[model samples]
Target: MKIGIISDSHDNIDAIAKAVEILNNSNVDLTIHLGDIVSPFCFDWFKKLRSDFLGVFGNNDGEVLFLDKKSEGVLHKPPFEVEIDRKEFILMHEPFGIEKLKTQYDYVLYGHLHKVDIRKTDRGCIINPGELCGCLTKKRTMVILNTTDNQTQLITV
Candidate 1:
């Protein structure tokens, strides 16, 4: 299974649209948003995704109730744990205590710093797909992870 990961969209509709297109074209089995989505209106772009998506609230995500409604209850508070493809995964908006969580999950995915970080540890992998809005690093990025092999491709959209 291939999972698409995106984060820190910050309400850039254009970037979000592009990312959705890329993920759809890539035929990802699932899409994960690492938050900083900013506003509920952003879901207008996100709704185009072909695959189901899950998300965690970032510090900038203020309209929690509406976001949850917009996401149809797929959005949750940070540090959410999920099992996908028979692998344990933890999703969070902030990279807090990631090192400690690494031992517990097959994948530790988080976003907040608006930078791309991907590394394989002895236990699993740590991934941050960067900022989809390109507000900080001036580069829009996302990730596609193959669960079968645990390999990831960093995509700049």
Candidate 2:
């Protein structure tokens, strides 16, 4: 199955809207977010549209419960795991957590730095979707992963 990944949105509604448009065009089975959705509006936008999403909390995610209140997606605090299409996927908001969780899942996804990159370790793949808000890095990005075959792709917005 095709899965879409996004993170560090930092509440840029326009950017998230663009990313959501891109994701919707990709024919993904679902979308998973790494965190920093930014504001209540951003969270509400996704909740009102899509029914499939998973997320985690980042250091800058102020008022966590507020975002969760409108989330149709899954949110993780630190280390969280889910099996999609029979493959185990782990998610976190920080890179350090990815390093620590390397050996525990088939894939480890994180976001903190507003830069998009992917690395393959002995245990699994670590990916950062970057900041879709395009604030710090002046670039927006997202990721797509194929749960069945371990294929990954990074998309810049």
Candidate 3:
């Protein structure tokens, strides 16, 4: 299965829209947003995702209740876990929490730092798709992860 990974959109609607188009064209099975989505209005771009989508709240996310209302049934508060195709995934907005359970999940995803990081470990892998907002590092990026073979491709927006 293919999974689309994104984070730190920071209310960049155009970038988010472009990324969604790419992910949809790739025929990803699902998409995961690591956080820093900012405002609830960004959910509109998220709603354009063609596959199943899920997200975790970031430090900047405001109006928790309203964000939930706009999430379209796929937002989790954070430090959430889910098992897919027997692979365990831990999702959060900050990488600090993931440091403690580094080797416990098949895939640990988080954003916060606005930098792309993909590392392999004895147990699994950790990935950060970078800042979709382009506020830092001046690059908007995302990732497509193939669960079957553990191959990841970084997409620059």
Candidate 4:
């Protein structure tokens, strides 16, 4: 299965739209938003996605209840875990929470710092899809992970 990962979108509708287009073109089985989605309006665009979507709340996310109500299918509370294709995946909005994990997962995903980072540890693969907002870094990016082989490709939007 292929999974699309995105984060730090900070309400850049155009960038989000572009990323969604790319993910759709790639035919990802699932899309995970690490956080900093910022606004409910921005998430509306995600409704157009063909793949399944899930997200965690970031520090910047406001109106939590409203966002949850509007994005019932997409939002997942932080530090959550799910098994897909027999691989366990953990999702969080901040990297710090990952350090406190007691169990190992096949993939650990988080977003906070607006930088693209991919690394492997004895435990599993760690990925941050970077800033989709392009506000601080001035570059928009995301990543697609091939779960079958645990390989990933970074894409700039």
| 1-157 per-residue lDDT for model 4 (tens digits) | 9999999998889998999899999999999999888888886799888999988989898878888888885687788888878988888888865555524787889899999989875656889989998998898989999988888999999
Ranking by lDDT: 1, 3, 4, 2
Choose the strongest candidate by TM-score.
1
Model 3 lDDT per residue over 1-157, tens place: 9999999999999999999999999999999998888889988778888899888999998777888888865788888899976899999888775666777888999999999999876666799999998998999999999989888999998
Clashing pairs in 2: none
- Clashing pairs for model 3 are none
Error of 2 at 67 (Å): 0.8
Determine which window of 10 residues in candidate 4 has minimal summed lDDT.
95-104
lDDT of each: 0.93, 0.78, 0.88, 0.87
lDDT (10s digit) by residue, model 2, range 94-120: 777566677777788888888887887
Give, for candidate 2, the lowest lDDT window spanning 10 residues: 43-52
- Candidates 2 and 4 compared: the better one by lDDT is 4
Query: Which of the numbered candidates is closest to the native, going by highest lDDT?
Result: 1
User: Model 3, residue 147: what's the lDDT?
Assistant: 87
Instruction: Please report, as a residue range, the 10-residue window in candidate 1 with the lowest summed lDDT.
Output: 116-125
* TM-score ranking, best first: 1, 3, 4, 2
